[model samples]
Target chain A: MEKAQEIIFAGFGGQGILSMGQTLAYSAMIENKEVSWMPSYGPEMRGGTANCIVIVSKSKISSPIVSKFDSAIVLNQPSLDKFEHAVKPGGLIIYEESSIITPPKRTDIECIGIPAMKEAQKLDKKQVANMIILGAFLKKRPIVKIENILSALKKVLPERHHHLIPLNEQALEVGRKFVQ
Target chain B: MGDNESKNEPRLMKGNEALAEAAIRAGIHAYFGYPITPQSEILEYFTLEMPKRGGVVLQAESELAAINMVYGAAGAGARVMTSSSSPGISLMQEGISYIAAAELPCLIVNINRGGPGLGTIQPSQSDYWQAVKGGGHGDYHLIVLAPSSVQEMADFVFEAFRLAEKYQNPAFILADGALGQMMEKVVLPEEGSLPYTVHNWATSGMGKRKQRNIITSLHMEPEKMEEVNLHLQKKYKEIQKEVRFESILTEDADILLVAYGLGARICQKVVELGREKDIKIGLLRPITLYPFPKTEIAKLASRVQHTIVVEMNAGQMVEDVALAINGKCPVSSVGRMGGMISSPEEVLHYVETMILKHFVSA
Candidate 1:
């Protein structure tokens, strides 16, 4: 595999942005890739917006800093505005259309605007928008297999969240099918 | 792998648990700590495991009391430790200075959180100065280790005890909240393999070994205290000689990115991106921040055109990096305050626009 790619996920505090980034990072590591998942906490995590950086690399990553991102998943309007311009020209941008008001201006990048929250609510689970975004991210990157992601989620999620796994899996499938 | 070794293979553990496990393997006899974010798990692990193994784990009333408990245990000639995040660590500085003055051997782990004053409960590298420079009163240094991963967190706990005993001083593991909370695969060291057997120097119950030993820093005579200060200075010099660190892609690079702990991990990704674009960048990650790999960094100053010190705090470690370079190379700093981590892209932009600009022009 090539060197690990760096990605950023941004959204409001309750949107599970950090969890999505962490799941992707953990899944990549479970697949034997070097990974780092850093979340913005304190006020940034409590207020209107939150973000996290996940770097998945084949080699020993020297620095986690990125001038440009390989991909970004924006879950809210603030996140979309903050990160849309930072994605590399050919890189992918996964946006949640239900939350993000403004569509990205740049037409050069690969943009996938999914109604993640609406889809989750349609499935009677409004909070799984983060899972929807992760599903989209997986479909776009395919760095780690979906099976690996499911297993990783199982390992990290608390017991109370166990039942949500199947629903999340379905949501992921919905996202994967949409992307396909 | 051999059968025994295979049986002792690595297991996934939280950084906090790994730290406690490593301490036990290193023959640490006592643990004194209070609960704090990113670090409370270490105490939890010790509370459960330490007693089973006949070790002491005491959760004192507060960080102040816990650090003082460590001071007492160290005075009694036992391998001891305490852990906390930024605010809790701030409360321990008074006792830390006392430990330094008395020349007691102990280990401290500071899982850094964002701060100026009770800033946030997130992982941050903001405690650079507080750990590296004297956090407490008086002029003394504590050996500080900055571990970036769960494996390193465990290994360094063992190393910190050994170093503290070897130098007859305090050693710190300056890990951040992220490192403390994250889970990763870690191989616990073999039991009894740690390189510390300090009973000869420890104050073990004042048995018939010569006379009753008293550990104190109460010399009224200024000259006597000056002598003690001189002795501590000599030890610091020796530590500098023994501990030096740096990372690669630094040679002949236009901009040298300097960071420690979590910041360094982020800078690593930035360096990889720079390499792909043929930007010719490098990184200098200081593993030991107190006896900071100064000489190693000074050497890099000659080859690297410019240096950028990236940190979570507002240019704390950057000051040390600048002092190490001493005008040999132009050093600049980029940092975030109130518990924010500098993003890779932000650091890279600064590198290209600021540090590498001079090189591009030349």
Candidate 2:
């Protein structure tokens, strides 16, 4: 196990970027690993470029803000434009391809583009794009187990949205297959 | 969020939400606050959680009204609290001073943002002077506690409320926006005993009691006001005696780093980074700001050749650190003002190039 894995999830506000980071952080918490999740806050987060940093570590995390990322999950073109350079030399950049016309051209970092919006539409739930990215993120990083993510989704999702659990599980599986 | 869930398991919680949950577990009676960036979650969490626990949560029209409501509730002997960011906290200073002078116990949380004015929404420790040096126009000191982690965010509310009740003075949780906004694993305290029962000192409607209770700070006579001021000073001294701090890796280190709240969290990592490079640096984290950990800092100053004070403000707490050392050792400061946050790497850069270059070995 690595000492720490710092991930940045970035996209527009309504793309569930914050929740994706939250679910990942919660999954890390379920594994009893120390985690810190910090979302881009303030009024600008409503419709602007929203990003969150999630650090999962074995030891206590010192700072929640990281200038460099071990991995980046970008949902839009701007996110890719902004965070593509932020990924470490050998780090991974998992992006949603449907919204990102210009894929990352960086040769140093590993880039995996999952057609998340297309997959979410295939699942008949456009809102599950974030979950698709989550699955792809796990496939790329495997920092936490898939079961941990499932349990984490149950915890992060509200009771009113519990009915969507099976759909979300399917979305996760679809995303995992996309990455594979 | 419930008490009946898995008790031992760690829950990921935001710093602001944790404060609300802890207050509920602490049996707080009422919460009054206004909507403010970075800290609106505190008031929102209380709105949802407090009403479930048969507590009152109100969103006042402004910070002034909210703090006055806190003063009213505390005056009537209810365990009440109010939270706001920098600008909003500045508005509440007058009410806070009255609460202190009237000797009403209450909890106040300042999830500080960048300031001097409505500076920025980002995290900053510029409120250090306002928090410790008395923001309001009075000779008063708040029992200020600086929480670094989400768990501390929750845990310190209980302690803050306890201290406020024990001293009959308002206790301030001086948390920065980073601490207020960040999420971390927190082992919340169990639903246990409260620090003090509200009915103990609260001035409720007297039915059986023969005498009427009044809570007011207006001392028109100079003699009476002087007596009140003298008593407050005595309480401040007692609190100073009980000041809490954490001296990390300072036993044999040559250079000491003094910081609190978010600054301390960042410097802790700097110390780790420094140790990796064989630079022997220590960190002194002051948990209590008002009762500024002067004793330990003074001692560390005597032992160490240099002390570098780090904060998000433009050298506010640096004054206190320099005062504590009192020229025993060279005390310098590195700060990020105007709502801009300096990363750990940046601080380490300053330490390596500037701080280490200027402050030579004894």
lDDT of 2 by residue, B1-362 (tens): 45536875788889998888888888888999999988989988887787677889999999999999999999888889999999999999999999988888898999888877878888889889999988898999889999999999999998998888888889999998889888999988776667556464568888687888878889899999999899999988888776999989999888899998888888988898888888889999999998988889999899987899999988989999999999999988898887777777788888888767778554
Q: Where is model 2 more than 4 Å wrong at Cα?
A: A178-180, B1-4, B198-201, B207-210
C-alpha TM-score for every candidate: 0.85, 0.95
Residue-pair clashes per prediction, in order, are 17, 1
Residue pairs with clashing backbones, model 2: B77-B202
Listed per prediction, chain B TM-scores read 0.94, 0.97
Task: Report the Cα lDDT for candidate 2.
Answer: 0.88
Categorize the docking of model 2: medium
Q: Which tens-of-lDDT digit does each residue in A1-180 have in candidate 1?
A: 575687988888888887787778768777777776655544554457888778787876545445468898888888787888889888899998877667888888998899887899889988888888788778878889988888778766776898889998988887876686
lDDT of 2 by residue, A1-180 (tens): 556998999999889999999999999898889999988786655568888999999988987877789999998899899999989899999999888889999999999999889989988999998888888888877889988888888888888998998898888888888775
Give the true-contact fraction for every prediction, in order: 0.51, 0.69
lDDT for B51 in candidate 2 is 68
User: Residues B19-54, candidate 1, lDDT per residue (tens digit)?
Assistant: 888888888889988998767888988888887788
